[model samples]
Target: MISLRRQPMPSTRVLATRTNRKTRKPMQFRGASIAFTLILPVFLIAASAATQTGEEGSIELVDPKVLRVCADPRDLPFSNEAGEGFENKIAALLAQKLGKTLAYDYYPGATGFVRNTLNAHRCDLIIGMPQGDDIVQGTNPYYRTTYALVSKQGSGLETIDSLEDPRLKAKRIGIVAGTPPATNLAVNGLLGNIKSYPLVVDTRFDSPTSAMMEDLEGDRIDVAILWGPIAGYLAKHAKTPVKVTPLVKETSGPRMIYRIGMGVRHSDQEWKRLLNKLIAENQTEITHILAIYGVPLLDENNALLTQ
Candidate 1:
């Protein structure tokens, strides 16, 4: 009677016991699920908050919905808020991509425009910033140009390549006051030879090239160093065919090749990134815009500099 006999456990009974344990364990599982349900929302909320904070921190302080742009009201081949210039087109394109309307701040071209307008937050972007302007941060250049010596055709000025050419030594060359060309000539020791013009009110005229045109026609100046677009347009449409010879050497002026970029506040890094992306995305459109303003599609190298 003290020795117990081993009996086989019924398979159904073993299964029933396991099933009971599983049924009881469901309650434990339900508690764990309830706990997770209570904690998960808080965890998710914290994660979402961190993500939003990071996103906000990464962008500049400026509102993404409004893009304030700056441009000279009278400068041609560059900007005019009246929507008549290439820079205006570029600005419009940028605004379109950003899904924002442009707010333009116009100012006369003075030495202090950058500080008075851009730094003062009068505008968020300057459309036609010269490359390497330290006053405002610049993006990658979207256009390139050179100073062209424009003169009446068949003037035996078939190929003037440099400002220092002996043939131009005694010639009166018309130059805009306070421009890079004028400064370059002065710095390269050619200022004395150049016939300088003050900031003539007529220079702000729709066709600023008229000053040079009058000078050339009047024989008051043998040649003029004007921006490529102006020179090209003048040459293409002049009563007398003007020969536009690009200068290749620059001892003091901008080298034959210079780039133009958009300007933004140094602190508006997010805007800058957006602009850079837009520029890259719209290269073909930008090229078309520049061509509409008469920028040459190729340089002396004959390479396709634009799309």
Candidate 2:
């Protein structure tokens, strides 16, 4: 989890994107304000072309020949240097639809991700961002997802869906600290027997989701609550059968679901519109790619779109 903050639940972090340049020293996290160090590297599918700029206040803020994306190079199930994440696939799809070469500005999706990459003019697009993210303008949402509870088969915990289920009171749970689900656990008094993983880490070395899943598989933790994409993808690929129950029934705290969209510079309305069109026209293919990666897709009404 690179700690890409989402609004509404301001402390909620989205897991996504990059590769080893240098791992930053751990920074102190206080309240909801987090300070972090970032790694910088650019991956280009073609040589850099002249910036296609317009007069001041123009909406043309991108390079015409390349769809330059800001992405994390090591975070899998989302993105990685090998172009294996769902975001990477979607970026490639958009680039092809736009007749532009795909390029990437790789950086850890840590605190300064948008500030250093997209805002710095190093790239023009971010493949995945929570809708309504304040730092960058967001296009129309491409997919909706929710937090999910993951448990190994035969654990008898698969039947538990709501956080308010009484059987959960006696089981140990694993969760990423500071996520919206943490608040739900707190309100339900389930934090008492929980293991809290860090919200931010260098993806090159640390994977909170993988560690949590390992614990759950080993019976060290009875269940793990994680973001839908990560939980669903990993469970689908895990060695043994696993059950993923989307937590759509949370009646308190921040809502468990989110809409994800592409991000662009605030001034680049043209770029945003172009992306929205791409999303609309190729939505079927996009959904297919997500399904291949095991993302739990949802419709606007929070209903499941895929099994």
Candidate 3:
């Protein structure tokens, strides 16, 4: 889930902006440091030889001197041009660790995000992508999260844990159409009162997440179901406190949970290995960053890691 944060304005304003984004399936490998260590040295030597010889199959997809990231110029909770989002911070951290300058290829995260940027080789990495996304090879998952139910604190509905909760039946709900949660809402007989926002939009002009949050705050909608990271971060910054309950209890339909990872072109096996090592080494710091951003983190057991 990408939230385009236009700079200078607050997070609320930024999150309201929309751009096209898509989700993909899980990758075949999870990050395993031992595997990377055993194979990386050979891979690097081969790549180096290829580069020195100007070989056609050199493993040099990205520029060697800089860590170039493909990012949405206006996305928040993920990235923005001003370098104000967690992804920006994480990118900087990785660049510093790798002794490379941090650079970006700015594009709105609307349709063709992967095709226009990473596949085009305009940049080398995307800071936040779902693990196993087919469009690009994914690093080991750095964090896991889920869709959540959001409501103002003190609203009787705040405690409702699942779509099957009886209290939600009478409430007007706001949700992004076509997201995984929408399927659950439909099957649970709760779609009738929903105010569905467009799934794919150009963030430069419209922001469904912001619209939904505005409606939620204004009482236009009694509750909302949104991606956990977006809802968690926005709720933490909201003028009125909001409750974010991760939808881990859903028993049917597509799973609302996802593991997130960094993305690179599939052919960049060495790059992917390097990033996996970085992620493994910096897991603690990364968790701290996510917590500061109010990202709702979950352990492998589906238990919440942050309030």
Candidate 4:
């Protein structure tokens, strides 16, 4: 009965510095305008030896001795100051390729993520952003993923591929308030019937996906719908087996797939180009990293990532 936006979380402390903060090279998304409109806007952070020239039509200054990145301080599975998230692993891979060390500008993925970090010239990169994001120029997309339907193991729902499945008519499904999968549910005429979790949770400030999974496993909800990576990773981590079926089929409207890329200042075309080349040479390796974290990788046809 209610409607809302999309959200992308978890913790804390420490900073680093490297001498050579040089530019790096690079590559999203779906819908009929849906691809352009249903963007999954994420956050960025990290402080470093960089400053904007404050001049119009010029790129910001970066030290070249380090890879200054913007990221959430506590959002695990994605990123954190502890360098445990998959994004952290990939950022390190990129910095090593560039022959520089990693540094971070840390903040919550709240309202001011872009303006306070990347746009402020405090950090130079956001490891995971949608391809068509307007805030910063995006490099080549390193991964494509879709939404997922999560259910308990042996729940007899593992084989379901689309929300249009008739069995779902009686299920108490859980969905984050503002994500693409929720949109898909609505398009399929299921919105008014499912449980709507807030896109942002104030309780310990955890990710809404976490709460959704808890509800699903606890039997408070029969199923949970979330972004592919989040659902895949969490499902892999559950103490009891869970089924994470990628939502590959939609009858109509906005597609649930999205392409993720690194983001840089619009003036940083040289850096963007550098990342694009790196992504090409390391595509296989990058895919491996995502797989290690159980991120469900999909192609345009909704097939699994084989290589």
TM-score of each: 0.70, 0.83, 0.82, 0.79
Among these predictions, the greatest TM-score belongs to 2
| Residue-level lDDT tens digits of model 3 in 183-270 | 8889899889899987556554677888899999999999988888788778887878889998899888777777888888878776
Residue 176 CA displacement from its true place in model 1, Å: 2.9
Error of 1 at 120 (Å): 2.5
Q: Write candidate 1's Cα lDDT for 1-307 as tens digits.
A: 0110100011100000000001001112458788898999887885567467755313343455677776666555566556787878888888888778777767554445566667776678877665676667888778766657787777876577677677876778887565556766776577777876543343322233566677887788888777666676566656777777665566654454566678788976656777888889998898888877667555547343543
CA shift of 163, model 1, Å: 1.6
The positional error of residue 205 in candidate 3, measured at the CA in angstroms, is 3.3
Q: Give the C-alpha lDDT of model 3.
A: 0.78
lDDT of 2 by residue, 26-115 (tens): 333454332222211121211122124423213355567888888877767888789998999999988888788999988767667777
TM-score of model number 1: 0.70
**How many times do residue backbones clash in model 1?**
0
Candidate rank order under lDDT: 3, 2, 4, 1
RMSD of 4: 12.1
Using lDDT as the measure, name the better of candidate 3 and candidate 4.
3
* Model 3 weakest lDDT span, ten residues long: 6-15
Q: List residue ranges in candidate 4 displaced over 4 A.
A: 1-61, 203-206
Q: What is the lDDT of candidate 1?
A: 0.62
